[model samples]
Structure formats: C-alpha cells, structure tokens
Target chain A: MKSPLSLEPLFHVGPAGITEPVVVSWAVIALLGLGSTLATRRLSVIPSKGQTLLELVVSTVDSQIRETMQADPAPFRALIGSIFLFTLVSNWSSLIPGIEPATAHIETDAAMALIVFVATIAWGVRTRGLRGYLATYAEPTWVMIPLNIVEQFTRTFSLIVRLFGNVMSGVFIIGIILTLAGLLVPIPLMALDLLTGAVQAYIFAVLATVFIGAAVGERHKPVAPSEKEP
Target chain B: MRIDWWTLGLQTINVLILVAILARFLFRPVIAIMDERRAAAAKMLGDAEAERAKAIAAREAAEAESGKIAASRDAVLREAAEAASAEREAALATAREEADQVRASAETEMRWARAAEESAASDRSARLAIDVARKLVARLPDSARVDGFIDGLARALASLPEASRDGFGAGERARLIAPRPLTAAELQAAHDAFARALGRPVDFAVVVEPAVIAGLEIETPHAVVRNSFRQDLKRIVEELTRHDGVHR
Candidate 1:
C-alpha cells in the first residue's frame, strides 16, 4: 500500500505531474456535477424525494453561511456549498476499492485552504473596501497589526493541517492495523475511520465558513463612554 | 511531506468548476422554485380570503333580504287580519240589520193577523147572537115581535133631530121596512106612533126587507130609524172588537 503522506504521479502533462489525488478530485468533481445537474433538471414546486434531499442540503448550507456571516448567503452559497460537498465526498471516497481519499493528501487540503483564504480576502475587500479590509489587522491597537496579519496566514495553514492530519492519520492507522491484524479484526477501526473522515470534512467546511464569515462580517466598533453608560 | 503544486492547481480548478456547476444546477433553481411556491401559496390564501369576504357579504345580503321579506309578510298579514276583522264586522252589521227588518216585518204581520182574527171572531160572535135572537123572536108570537119593534121605532123616531122631522113632513114619501108583512092594525098603529113621535104628520109606506133580519125600520125622506136585533148585534160586535184590540 502506498504511504498516505506521498502522492504517486498517475500521469504527466509536460512539466507538471498529474497525481492520484488530482485524478480522484476530478472524479469527485464529475460525480458532484452530474448529481447536481440531474437533481436540478426536473425541479418543481412539488418536489420528489431526490429533489427534497437536494434542497435540504442546499438550504442547510445556505442557513449555515447566513448564520456564520450574518449576511445574505446568496453571494457565498456556491463556494461554501461546493467546499462542503467536495470535502465530504472526497473523505468518503476511500470506501471504494483502490481509491484513496483526495482529502488524505496535504496538497488537496492545502489547495482548498488556499482557496478559502483567497476567497475570504476577496470577500473582505468587496464588503469593506481594500483600505478597510487592510484596517482589520490594526484593530484594537496598532501594536497588534503584525500578530494579526500573521494570524490570518496561520489560521489558513491550520485549516489545511487539521483536515490533512485527521484524514491522512486515519488512513495510515487503518492501513497499519489491516497489515498487522486479520482483515475482520480491523473492521471496527475502519468504521471509526469512516466516522473520523466525516467529522474531519465537517470541521474543514465549518472552519472555511468561519474564516469567510470573519472577512464579510460587520466590524464591531468600540462604544463611546456615553453610549456604554446608556 | 512533498507538496505537489500541479495537484494543488488541478484540485482548485476542480473545486471551482464544481462550485460553478452546482450553483447553476442546484442553488439557483432550488431557491427560485421555493420562492415560486411561497408566492403561489400567498396568492391562493389571498384569493381564499376574498372569496370568504364575498360569501360573508352575500350571506349578509341574503339575511337582510330575508328580514325584509319577513317584515313585508308581517305587514301583509296584519293588513289581511284587519281587513278580515272589518269584513266580519260589516257582515255582522248587515246580518243584524237584516234580522231587524225581518223582525219588524214579522211583528207587523202578526199585528195584522191578530187584527184580522179578532175582527173575524167578533163578526162570527155577532152573527151568532143575531141568528139566536132572530130564532128566539121567530119562536115567539109574530104579534108580540111586531109590537116590540113598533115601540122601539116610536122611541127612536121621537129622538130624531127637528130638521129630520120637518123633512118628513115636506111631502116626500116615507116607508116602514120589516122582516115580514104587517097586519092592517099593526101598520096603522106604527103610522100613528111614528106621527106622534115625529110631532108632525108624516106619510109612511110598509115595505118588506129580508136583509133587515128580525127588525123594524121606519123610513122618512131624510131619516131612517132602526130598532132591530141586527142593529143591536152590530153594536155588540163593534164593542167586542174594540175590547179585543185593547186587550191585545
């Protein structure tokens, strides 16, 4: 079995090597795309079971984004919902034989985290203007500017590390247990790994929502002495 | 751990593509359909509310109409009752008037019948009395009946007015009527008695009149004196009829 930490190249396109995680990510994308298209094709006011399930998923995502950001979910729904579905599907893809979960690779997790980081800044700039977005680092006092700026990057890094570590460690531990013990003995560990995969996907999506919400959320201004007294 | 930049790039592109596809096919359409259903439900509710209001208004109008009909019906009933009462009263009055007229007519008829019956009864009693007197006088001697009528005639002639006595002496023929022929002595006696009672000379003739029943009547040119059972019976009949009328 391949090491969970290393990504084996499946193909090469000139200077860039196409890896297993990247190929699996394409499959996940295609599956999600086809499912969304089919689910939405015959939508009506009166919904079927499949349409109901799809709508539930979409509304759940929208409510989460709305609650976290304290803003309209229209602008952020597509990106946040896609992140949640892709991570969830990718984490569970390990159930298929000869298919490793794309989220187990640091590269895929980092890419998703980088996307979230970039989107947060973009949304912050859109909501608060570029100068106001930059002003968030200097909040409370000017001395906290450096630490606040570093905290942004570190928080994004933590998002990537948290998802990658949880998913990759679960895969690695399950592999080690399957190697040492009989196949039936590792069934409990595999079940636990599935639970861990689901939890990790949820955590990754929740963190992304928080990071984006922080960017688009209204800044709390310090109340004056007179206002506080009231 | 080795970082693969190409895989990172590919995964980011895949995620972006997934976002685009999912948003286009799922989020936009689902939200739109939900909004449409909500709007449709609201419209249906509004229509139902409007229909309810219309139904209420129609019911109110119907109730008002029913009230009006009831009021009109009551008025008609009252009028009909009053008319019926008036008609009944008028009918009663007419019936009473007819009853009064019938009663008056019946009373008049009874009075006329009573008068006729009394007159008939009195006439029958007088005729019976006259017949009895005539039969009794006929049973007596003819001379006695003649002598009795002659004395009554003499008394009646003496009570005559002076003008009637003077008219008898003016040379008009005078006659004496009797139920039967008189004897010569009886006629001479009647003439001498009449002359003495009249206080002048009077020419008298003897005549038979069966209609005079059993009586003697002295006839002069201007006066006739009757002293007979028939005259006495007529007087009695008149008296009895008057008495019967008074009693009634």
Candidate 2:
C-alpha cells in the first residue's frame, strides 16, 4: 500500500532527463540574479530606488558583521555578507509556484556547509599561520590531538545535517498537510514556511559570522568592560 | 524509501551552476556597495567631530577678542578720569593764585588809604592851631607894641615846666609841660639838646597821650602858660570821627 504522504513522481523521462525540481532551481537562480543585478546597477550618491533596497540588505548584513566580528570587518566582509544574502534568497525561492526549497536536499545543504567550513579553516590558518591553527586542536597537550581532530570532523558533519534536517522537515510537514486537507488547509502551513525560510537564512548567516569571528580569536570576543578601558 | 542516484546527479549539477552564477554576479556586487556605504558613514562622523572642534576654537577666539576690547575700554576710562581730575586740580590752583593776588592788592590799597587819611587829619590839626593863635592875638590888640608882647608871651608858654608838680594842680600842669614815659636813651638825647639852652642838668618823663596832641606846654612854681589847647581839641575831634566811622 502507498503511504498518504508519498511524493514519488507520476511520470518519468528518458535517461539524463531533467526533473521538475531541477528546472525550478534553475529558474530561481535566474530570478535572484536578475533582481540582484537590477538592484545594484547604476549606483548613486543618493541611491536609486532599487539600489536603495539592495543597500538596505547589504548594510544590514554589514552591521551584523560589525556587531559579531567587533574588529576590522575588512577580512570577513566579503564572505559573510555574500553567504547571508545568498542563503536568504535561496531559502525564500520555495515560496514561488512550482518550486521546491533546494536547501531541503542534503547535497545542496552540504555544498553550502562546505563553503563555510572551507572558509573557516582557511581564515583560521591565515590569521594564526598553519602551525598555530592546527595546534589549536591539541589544546592542552599532544595527548588530546586525536580527540581534537575527531571533534573537527564532527563539527563539520553537524553543520551539514542541522540545515538539511530543518528545511526538509518544513517541506515534509507542508506536503503532509496539503495531502490531508487538500488546498486551503495548507495556508497556515505556508505562513509557517515563510517564517521558517527567514529563520533558516538568519541561522546560517549568524553561524558563519561566529565561525569567522572564532577564527580571528579576539575579533568577535565579547564586548567586555576591558575593551573600553584602553 | 529508496535511493535515486541519477536524479541526484542531475540535481547536483543544476544546483552547482545556480550557486556559482549567483555568487559571482549577485552577492559580490552587493557587498562592494555595502563597503562603500560604511566608508561614507565613517567619513561623515570624522567630519562632524572636526567641525565641532573648529566651532569651539572660533568661540574661544571671539571671547578673547571681546575680553581684550573690554580691558582696553576700562583703561581708556581710567585714563580719562585721571585726565579730568588733573585738569580740575590745575584750574583750582590757578583760581587760588588769582584770589591771593587780589587779596594782596586790596591790603596794599587799604594801607595807602589809611596813610592819606592820617596826613589829612594832621594838616587840619595844624591849620586849626594856627587859626586859634591868630584869634587870641587879635582879641588882645592889633597895635605893634601889643602884637610884639603877645608873640613874646606865646614863645614863653612853650618853655619846660618844673619837675616838682603833681596831679591836675601844679604837678599836673608840670606833667603837661614835660614829657613822661620817656626811655633813658630818649631822655639822654633830650637833655643833650636842651642842656645848652638852660645851662643846667635836665631830667624829664614822656608819655603818649591825646591830652597834649601837637603843641608844647610850660609850668613852674613861679609861672604857667598853655599853647596846646587848639591842637588837643583838633586831635580829640579826629579820634571821635574814627570811632564813629567804626560804629557806622
């Protein structure tokens, strides 16, 4: 017997044929690119309408970096600001008709996590030199080196799983709700989808900022009283 | 659930292409614009601080200038007061000097007026004495013999009196004929002048009085005569006039 929540497609294409999800992902990317380009082109002293909207988004991301990094935003500005906007748009793409959230798939989520993980490692090594960055794992002594290395792999795995699980859960719930009640019943769940989209985007951006901050050590250190002392 | 490897492969390729294009074109340019905006905010904050400092400096300079102007004004006022006081003192000194000169000239004029009045009084006394003498002689006789005898009598009346007389009797008459209250030097000079005429030692006392004003008198145990009556009357009248002038 077929489960009520089964999502198996009704039709099939020939070998190397495209699916609806792939086609929708491609269209979402194109839309995001067009919107971003129109918003960015022909910059002004006092921004044009589209430019103003883009500046608002970029400035919001920049402020978050300044708050988290708390140091010169020069180094982490490019990576963190890009990740924030990209994740936000990608997560929101599922709201359009005939499209699915690509982040709900493990492969897509892993790709994004890998970008952050590689950047984190690169920045850590660059800031403290390779020897120093690797030595951070040793922590107390040489005896803990193996455990520290295992911890690094676990951390990377968790990053990929966390985003994947959350987004997949939202899709699964929406599908289950739609199948049970048919059309209008999915409206409340759709509202929840919008919230979930924005929350996921925020979590991904903040986590990236925190990871970069950790790489630079005292860069994102708490705004302690001693900071204002000197 | 079952795995679908082929579907996953195609989806992976599609996702990769989408991410790559979006990252390159969309996110990259947005971040660039953000950086430009951040730099502009920092510059504006710095400019505001600089303007605040400049405004404070300008205010301080204005205060200093006003303070200097006030000090100069005070100094000018002080100098003006001092100049005014000096001018007042000079004027006062000139006024005092002129007043002193006027007072001195008034004192000199009063002295001259007093001397002229004294001379006029003395001339009147002399003229009255001469007139009285002429009247006395005319009552006696106008003949040459009688005129010559009266002239001789008048001469005899001017002679010195005896020294033993006292009071208004014989002694008073003698005092009226002789000088009283005389110093030893004046007595010595008088004796030296009259000793040759009398051919004897002479001693007398002289006193200043209005009783015998301008003429001499003689009195002795043997004889007595007076020629000082009219001169004494004239002196009395003049003194009475001076007293009346003071009262008036």
Candidate 3:
C-alpha cells in the first residue's frame, strides 16, 4: 500500500506542485460554484422546487450559525456556510471512484483550521475591538492570561488533528480491508467510513462555530439577582 | 502524514473562492428575495386593512343617509296628511254654507210667493164683494132707492154743526148726485127734506150720476154728505188693500 501521507503531484505551476487533493478540491469548488450560479440565476418571490431546496440549505446554515453564536447570522453567513458546504462536499467526495477526499489530508485540514483561527480573531476584534478582545484572555483573573492565550492555538491545533485523523484513519482502514478481503468484503467498512467522514465534517463545523462564538459572544459574567436591572 | 505547503495554499484559495461564489450568487440573492417577499406581504396586508376600513365607513354612511331619507319621507307624509285633513274640513264647511244659503233663499222665495197670493186673493174678494153689492143695488126699484138715499142724506145733514147748516143755507148752489137720473118728484122731495134738516131755505140743484151706485150725495159750500153704494164700495176696497199690505 502506498503511504497515505505522500501526495502524488499531478502538475506543476512554477515552484508550486498541484497534487491529487488540490485537483479534487478544484473540482469540488467548480461543482459548488456552478450549482450556486444555476440555482440562483433566476430568483423569484414564488420559489421553484430547486430554489426551495437551496433556500432550505441556506436558512438551515443561517439558523445553525445564529443558534451557536447566539448573535445575528448576517456577517458570518457566508463564512460559516462556505465552511460547512466545503467540508461536507470534501468528506462525501470518497463516494466517487479514484477520488481522495481533501479533508483526509493533514495539509488541507491544517488550512481549514488556520482559516477558522483567523476568522475567529477577526470577528472578535470587530465585535469587541482589538483591546477588548485581547483583554478576554485575562478573564476571571490576570494570572490565567498565559493559559487562555495558549488555549487559542491549542484549540485550533485540535481542530486540524481531529478532522485529519478521522478521515485519514477511515481511508486507511477501508484500503487495508479491501486489500486483505476482496472488494465486496470491504463494502460494509466503506459504508462505515462514509458515516465517519460525515461525522468528522459535522464535528469540524460545530467546533469552528464554537470558536467563532466564543470570540464574538458577550463577555462571560456571573449572574446575580441583585445585579439584574429592573 | 506529510505536510504540503502548496496543497495548503491551494485549498485555502479554493475555499475562499467558494465562499465568494456562494456569497455573491446564493446567499445575497436568496436573502434579498426573502426580504422582498416579506415586504410585499406586509404591504398587501396593510392595503387590505385600509380597504376594509373604507368599506365599513361607506356602509355606515349609506346607512345614515338611508335613515335620513326615511325620516324625510315620514315628515313629508305627515305634512301631506295634515294638509289633506285641513282641506277636507274646509271643503265640508264651504258645502254647509252653500246648503244654508240655498235653504234661506228657498224660504224667502216661498214667503214672497205666499204674500203675492194673499194680495191677489184679497183683491179678488174685494172686487167680488163690490160687484155683488152693485148687482143687488141695481135690482132695487128706482123710487125706493131714491127715497132710501134721501132719508139717509137728511139724517146726515141734521147731524151737521149749526154753523155748517147755516153755511149750507147761505151757499150759492148745492149739488146732489144719484146713481141714476132722478124724477121731478124725487128732486122736489130731496129739496124739501134738506130744507127741513137745515131749518132754513137752501138753494139746491140736483145732479144725476150713475156712479153713485143707487144712492144719493149732497154737496154744500162748507160740507158734503155721501150716502152712496159707490162710495161704500170704494172705501171697502181701500180698507181691504191696506189690511192685506199690513198683514204681509
């Protein structure tokens, strides 16, 4: 079996090498772009069946974002919606023969986690201002500042490891089983892998939502009956 | 697992591109459409509410106008009834007045007709009485009539005042009238009778007249004596005519 870690370069664009995962991601992007354009080409007050479906998806994402962040979904709709759709599409890409899901790679997962990390900071700064956002690390006590600062990078690292580990393990197990037992014997494992891929994508999205919520949410405070306004 | 910097950069770029595409083509347009539909629905609801209010107001106005019309109609009907009643009463009063006038005129006409009838009857009676008396006296003997009238004339002359008797004696002439021509004997007898009643001599000329109605009439310068059926009949007719006028 080939090493799951090593990417086979399909082409070169100057010093940069275009790999299999990169090619597959471009295909996913193209499919998503084309679908979006087609679905939204003619919008109406009275929705078509296709438009109903597209709206349902968008609204579901919007609701999920609102629920998780406990804030308005307007500013974060595109970012969160894009993340969920990309992750879901990448995880499900294994259904296509000869296509390796981009989420199964360490590089792709790292990039996604890095995006979440940066987006959280940006949103936090926008909501609380740079000084207030920085001040959040010193919450509860000034002594917890160092630990709170470490927690940001650690959580981002955990997101990458979690998505990459789950997708890569599913791919590896399916491959090993298919090699040992015939292709038909590995069908159940492949189905299980599909489930695992879906779960991993969902977990990644949920965690990203949590991180972004923490960044943009109102500063945590203890509830006291005496402190409540009339 | 191996990390590839190029793959990482490529994936990041793809995700950004996807987000941009989805935001532009999908999220923005879909959200805009939803907002527009919501706004349209609200506008339609507001317009429906306004129309309902206008309809209610119009219905109320129509009802008010109908009420006013009904009231006016009733008032007009009342006035018409009053006018009709007044006109009926006036018509009845006029009819009664006309009936009374007709009754009064009929009574007056009856009274006038009765008076005229009575006057005619009285005139006829008077004429018949005079004619009957004239016919009776015409059947008398001339001598007997002359003698009877001479006797009445002598009595009337005796009743005269002494001065009037003296004046008769002094008169130039005296007239004597009878309803028929008098005989020579009747003339002489009349002169003697007058002279004896007067107790002096009286110049006498006898005049014969049929209009005396078989009676005698003597005239002197100061007095006259009438004892004629003609005179009696004239007085009786005048009295009857006067009595009829007074009764009427």
Q: Candidates sorted by TM-score, descending order?
A: 1, 3, 2
Docking class of 1: medium
TM-scores for every predicted model: 0.73, 0.64, 0.65
Best of the candidates, DockQ: 1
Q: Positional deviation of A41 in candidate 3, in angstroms?
A: 1.6
Off by over 4 Å in 3: A180-203, A218-230, B53-248
Better of 1 and 2 by lDDT: 1
True contacts kept of each: 0.84, 0.30, 0.80
What candidate 2 keeps of the native contacts, as a fraction, is 0.30
| Tens-digit lDDT string for candidate 3 (B97-141) | 888888778877777678778888888998898888878878887
Q: Model 1: per-residue lDDT, tens digit, B3-38?
A: 888888988887888888888887888888888888
Q: What is the interface RMSD of candidate 3, in Å?
A: 1.0
In TM-score terms, candidate 1 sits at 0.73
Q: Residue A158: error of model 1 in Å?
A: 3.5
For candidate 1, the TM-score of chain A alone relative to the native chain A: 0.91
Rank the models by DockQ, top first.
1, 3, 2
Candidate 1 or 2, higher DockQ? 1
